[model samples]
Target: MSKDTSRVRLTAGRVEAFTCPAGKAQAFLWDTEAPSLLLRATPTGRKTYAFESRLNGATVRISIGTASDWSLDTARKRAAELKQLIDRGEDPRELEKAKASHKAAAKAAATAHALTVGDLWPDYLETGKPKRRDAWKPRYLEDLKRMSAPGGEPKKRGKGTTRPGPIYPLLALALVDISEDALKEWHDNEARASKHQAARALMMFRGFLRWCATKPKYRGLVDNEAGRAPAILENLPSMKRRTDALEAAQVAGWWAGVEQLNNRTASVYLRALLLTGARREEMAGLKWADVDFQWRKLTIADKVEATRTIPLTPYMAQLLATLPRVNEWVFASTKTLSMAVYNAKRRERDATQAGRTAPAGEVSTVSESGRMSDPRSQHAKALLSAGIEGLTIHGLRRSFSLLGEAAGAPAGAIAQVMGHKPSATAEGYRPRSVDALRPFLTQIEAHVLALAGVQFDAQVEPGKLRVISAQ
Candidate 1:
């Protein structure tokens, strides 16, 4: 019989010797051992191992590899495996695709397994935000950064390196390893030093886990509720609602002590907190643009809303006019310590200079934020001088609520001026326009001033300073 040259057994030598005809675009040589297997060559001498077969009345050609990468015998064995899939009435192309998909899934799983919380924390901070907010507020964002900070740098106020943040330890943990048991252990360890700080950190971390769960790539890797596991919640410190406001009688002393403060700006800030019942930060963030002396109104940054306008009482307008327009801030920061405080610190440094010489440069009391930052230390000094114990900065806010009621102002009006969320039980709970809120605010201010024994003259020209006298 004549040699059947169309079907020849493939060999490394025969495959190498094969070439496409000069005028033809391509040529093929079929292996007798695996009839579906073929070595294909192009006119430019490119060659490859491929499996070609009929499946469901259509021809399917699958490229296995290049001629150099696969030996003749290995190519034949792979082709035989593909043919088996076709014989079983399955598409070899589909089988090859399934294998590729499984390989890709395994690779992705490996990559996910290697991911740590530290790797994704920055991304979370950048995109994650509280409900109804466009982005994290600057204060809250700083809190988040502090919670996860790796602290080895020198303290801002003292001698030693700062401690690592409460959440820093968890950053090294792999996302897949975050479990109820893991979080419970971390919470227990952190709660040892400061229960409230640890609890706050846990709350913030839960926000992180919630954000991660929303991502497709990180979905299955973390359990969003792990931070809130019952084991962890049970150990949280009992939350105590602070009731530390100035008593009606204590207001006279607080006012006197505040007026005696050496830092005039701090004295004004502390008094402003009491008079307006604004949160410390909200008051500190005040700008000159937000004050409207001509309209006898002040626009305050509200905690519950974008902004709230309240009538600027006579005393407050006069009080504001006394403040120098140092910068944009209604209460601008001086960024320097009072002469007495600075002298005391200098004396202490001189006393300790024998061991190690202090750095010889100006000591900045606080970073210049263009607005007043923490007045707590000065507030504490004021409290101590007044012989009033347990009164907090927020206590001033509570005091305003208590005193406003004592002054017979409606609950809704008090709530509105204080930037509190209105409730159904508050009288006239509906939102009142700034003008309608005027009489109530002025009434509250008058009552507070009377209690503090402050006498003020409101007869000055608009935008001019009105004199206030303390009895």
Candidate 2:
């Protein structure tokens, strides 16, 4: 009922005895020691410590804390600090906002700093580069992605029967946790069922670690030496590099059998691989745009150089020209199969925008697969028909090199045609132009045709069907 007129030294006892005015919306007790600091209570008896000051000619008031949480001295100190800030023409609210922002930023940084390798893998696949090659080859990129895939189905042996990814378990581990011991454990487990695949996976993972070390975001977070640890390294099974090549005597049988294949496109695709010595994926992923019939050259995806142009020999041109143009793919297949193509770039672009999808209709290069399928069984069937045995699909590529050599083409010429960097001195001897390589490719094709006991008049224009004249 009566207005209090004096300032008081605030205390626990004073604070406990303070009462709210029944008639007023709020009441205040100004501290005598700190005049600007006050204890305010609502009519319902809710109390808090607060500070008041004039800022930019306007009275600005700020709530400090409740009487229970903050002592009298603490409130006084806060009031003084606010007073000084106001005197310096600084807004206390801006300072508070800045402090809050800094705290939030620190929390966000902590969250990001501990990002797992799995967390960064997707973006890295989209943008990260490895030391082995400039951009990731489609096959290698697919392997990296599938390695960490959260597996689509359950396994039969483990928790259940499904094909889980090899690297899926490691996804939960932080990038910093990929130590030598962790890698050893992973290697031991993987080796139990598939030693060779595990060895390959470990090698791939090492490259990933090296890539992580180069990134500022992941620097010092990965111990790349983990993959090279002696415990894991010693367990790696020694694998012999396969050197299967098509024998000159077998080319005849191989050619006859490949010609009899039900899938003509696949048949030609196989022979093309052998004829050009091109990598399997490169030949399978061939686009119509990459084929320059006018220039008699085929531009193919090269592992060593990203891409390279090989002389499209007369026989090879005829084979390609005879095939139907299903889409952008030169060896287009109508049959549906799972595609392991689309690299990080395609996948990333797809995630951002919906359209511009892969080879489908006009945009699509091949069918579900952008490249040719492995023709192992079909090739085997052809081989059996031709009375040949024990020839693997990849042997066709080796055949091209061997046959090229037998035909007197230099090692450099074969390596260049095969999309290899040419480890031999023969391949390293001056770059062979498409024109220079043409003769050797043509000669190899002729010799293979002769072995098959079939002859073609390459003088005829490519893609022109030869009809027998009626007598």
Q: Write the per-residue lDDT of candidate 1 for residues 1-471, one digit (tens) a residue.
A: 112226788887999999887877778888898899888888889889899898888888899898989998899889998888899999977776899999999999998999999999999889898777798876688899999999998987659998999999999999999999998888888889889999999988999998999899899999998987877888888887999998888888999999899877889888888888898888998888999988988888876678888888887887777775655777876653343246547766886877665554433334333676789998998899899998889999999999999999888888888988666337757778889988888898889999998876668754465436665
Residue pairs whose backbone atoms clash in candidate 1: none
Error of 2 at 468 (Å): 13
Each model's total of backbone clashes:
0, 12
lDDT (Cα atoms) of all candidates against the true structure: 0.83, 0.76
- Kindly provide the TM-score of model 1 when superposed on the true structure, using C-alpha atoms: 0.75
Q: Which candidate is the best by lDDT?
A: 1
Per-prediction TM-score, please?
0.75, 0.60
In the range 1-471, model 2's lDDT, one tens digit per residue, is 116434798888998888886777777898888888988888888889988888877888899999889988888999999989988999898899999999998886687667887787777788776655577777688888777777656652348645556777777788878999998898888778788878887877787787787887677677868888887777789976887777777776677778778877778888788778787778888998999989999899887667898888887888888875646677665352223233334665785687655433222233443445566777878888878777777778878777777887778777777877656546346778899988978887777666666666677788873522211
Candidate 1: list runs displaced more than 4 Å: 1-5, 9-13, 53-60, 83-91, 152-163, 247-250, 253-267, 284-311, 317-389, 410-413, 420-438, 460-471
Cα deviation of 60 in candidate 2 (Å)?
30
